[model samples]
Target chain A: MTTTLTASKEQSCQTLLASGHTACTGCGEALAAKLVLGAAGSNVIVTDATGCLEVFTTRFPQSSWEVPFIHSLFENSAAVASGIEAALKSLGRQNEAKVIAQGGDGGTADIGLQALSGMLERGHDILYVCYDNEAYMNTGVQRSGLTPFDCMTTTSPYGEFSWGNKHNKKDMPGIAAAHNIPYVATASVSFPKDIENKVKKALSITGPKYLQIHSPCPLGWRSNPQLTITVARLAVQTGLYPIFEMENGKITKVRKVSTPKTPVEEYLKIQGRFAHLFKSPDGNEEIRKIQEIADRNIEKYGLA
Target chain B: MRLDLGAIAKAGTSKANQTCGWRNFKPIFHQEKCVGCGLCKIYCPEGCVTMVEKKKYTVDYTYCKGCGICAEECSSSDIEMVVEEK
Candidate 1:
C-alpha cells in the first residue's frame, strides 16, 4: 500500500492505528495502541470496548483506525471478538485475520470480567488486551477495581472521609493466568518495544491469550503531559508495576529493577493525584503504606 | 425511522482533524544537535515525526498536538520546546 510518501508521517507509519486522535497530549494508551497494532500488522480485526482509546480514535467519521475495528459496548468486546473468531473458523478463513479484543481497566477488571471469563473458558483464538490506566478515565476519573490503593479519583476523592481508593489494585494477570490460558503478560507503555514484542508473541500463540498493559493518563493521573514516558518508566523502576510474562499459570520472565531501586516517592511526587499523600503525618503513614506495597511487589516478583 | 443500515459512520480519517491548534508549546528540531538515535520518533505519542532523510527527522505540524515528548525524550536534546507564537 506504499504510495507517494506523505510529509505528515502517514506513509512512513508502520501502524494500523492512525494518528490525529483526540487522546490527551502525551497519551500513553494511544502510543501503546499504535505499538500493539503496528506489531500485529494490518491483517487483523480489532474489537474495542468503550474507553479513551475507542472514544478518541473512533469519533465517527473522523477515525484513526486503518484496520477493521468494532466497538460494540463497554462490556462485550471479548464476546464480540469470540463471535468474530467463531465466524472466521466457520468460513474457513481463520488463518487470514487475527482477532483482538481490548478495553480499559473498568471494562476489563470490573464491568467486562464475566464476558472475558467466558471467552477464556471457551478458549477462543483471540488476544484480550486490557489497557489499565487505573480508572474509568473516559467517563471522568472514577475508581475502578484496578485503581491502586490511595490513588485519587472522582469517586474516591482524598479527604477526611476517605483515603483515595482504599482497595488495592486487582490481580488481573493472576486471574487471567488462572484460566490456564496459553499466555498472559503484563506490560507498560514506557517499554514500547517490549509491548510490540509481547503483542507479537501473544498473537503467535494459539488459544486465549491475555495482555494487561499499564498506560498512563495525563489528565486523570494529574501528571505532566510531557512526562508520560518518564512516569511509566518510574512505575516499573519503583516496582509498583511488575512487567512479566506467564505461561500456563507459571511466571516465565520478569523485568528486574536496576541497581538503585527507585524510591516510590520519585513516582508519587510527579503526579498531583498522589500529592495529598505528602501533606501531613497521616499522609506520611499513607506514603509508608504505599512504599510497603511497592517493597512487597519488588520482593514478590523478585525484581531486585 | 426504519433503516437497512445498522448505524455506521461514513469512511473517514482523523487526519481531517488538524490538532495543531491544540499546541501550547511547539518543538523546534535542531539538526546540528541531533544524533540520529530516532528515540524522538519512537516516543512521539502522535506519530507525527518522520525521517525525511537519513539521520534527519521532521515533524508534521498539521497533526502534532505539541506534547513535547520528542523534546523530553530526545537523547541529544536536539528538540527544544518553545512557547507557541500565535
Candidate 2:
C-alpha cells in the first residue's frame, strides 16, 4: 500500500487518462480506466472493445486518451492487441512499449470471450483488463454473462415471475488462469494501489495476463453517486468479490478481509439493483442465498 | 470553451464544462487537518482536487461532480461534504 502512495503521487503530475469525458458523475469504470492507464503509463498502446469505456471516452471528434489507442469493434480488443504486440515486436519496439486490451464485462465475458481466449491461448504479450460493472451498461443495462444472480437489470428485471438474473457471474479470472498465463488477478477501483501494482506486475510479464476489476456502476446499480467507492470497498470486504493474484494457475497472494468482516447486506443494501432482495419473504430468501454465495467464496478463496 | 474543429480536443475538456451546478453536495477541505498525502487527488474521478502547496490542496469546483470520494479517502478526515445551496 505504501507503494500505492508513491504511485499516486507520481501519477498525479502526469495523468494519462485526462478527465472531461461524458462518463457519469461517479462512474466506476471511468475511475478504473484512469487508474489503469495511469499505471500503464504513456509508453503503452491501448486496444479498446466497444463498450461504455469506448463510447464515453472516445466520442467521435473528442478523445480522452493521451496514448496510441484503437477501438476494435465489440469483441476483438484482445485480438487487436495481439496484432499490435506482434507489430511492435516486428518493429523491434516490443520491449519499449506495452499492449493493453480493455473492455467492459459484457465485452470481456460475453461477446469478447472468444477473442480473449484465443489471445490467452496464443500467449501473446498483452494485458487484458476487464472492467466488470456486472452488465451491459452501455447498451441500456442488459444482463451479461458476468451479471450476478438475483441482481436486477433492464433485461433481468425482478418481478412476480422472476428474480433478476438467474445465473451466477462467470468465473472470468478462473477462465483466464486456465490458460496458464503468468498473472491473473481480481481488483476493485476502491483499492487503487492493488490495481496499479497488478497492472505493473502484469506488464512486467511477457505472456497474456488477465485483470478483472470489480467496478460498480452507479447508474446501473441505482446507488448514490457519492457512495461508489464505499460500495466497491464493501464488495471486497464482504467477500463477495475476492481480490487475489494467481501465478501459473496457483494462488500467490490474497488480500485478506479486515477483522470483524463486513456482511453481504452492507454491500447489497446500497444498490437499488439489489433492492428487491430486501423487500419480502422471497426477497429475504434470495438475500440468504446471496449471502451463502459470499460465504462460499470466502471458504473457497480463503478470503479470511 | 471554443471547439477547434480540426485540432484534436484537449485531453481535459471537462474542465471548461462546469459540472458543479449538478452537485447537491460539495467537498470542503479543512487545511488544519490536511496531511498532503494526495490520496484524494488520486481517487478523485474528475481529477478536480489539485495540490496547491506541499501540504495544501484545493478542489476545482467547476469540474468536480461532488462524488465525495475526496472526503471518503482523505487520510486525515480533512475533506468534508457540505450541502450546496440552490
Q: By lDDT, who's the top model here?
A: 1
Per-residue lDDT tens digits for candidate 2, residues A1-304, read: 2113633365633567666667887889988998888888899989899999988787766777888788858999999999999898899988888999999999999999999999999999999999999999998999999999899999999999998999998899999998889999999998887888899999999899999999989999999887888889888888899899999989999987655867788899999999988888778788888888888888888988
Error of 1 at B33 (Å): 2.3
lDDT, candidate 1, residue A148? 95
Q: What value of lDDT does candidate 2 attain over all alpha carbons? A: 0.85
Per-candidate interface C-alpha RMSD? Answer: 4.6, 3.0
Candidate 2 matches the true fold with a TM-score of 0.92
- Deviating ranges (above 4 Å) for candidate 1: A1-13, B1-4, B10-12
Per-residue CA lDDT of model 1 for A1-304, tens digit only, reads: 0011122333223756667789999999998888788778888999999999989998876788888888888999999999999999999999999999999999999999999999999999999999989999999999999999999999999998777889999999989889989999999987777787798899999999999998999999999999998899898989899999988888899988756778889999999889999887788888889889999998988888
TM-score of each: 0.95, 0.92
DockQ for every prediction shown: 0.49, 0.36
Q: What C-alpha lDDT values do all the predictions have?
A: 0.87, 0.85
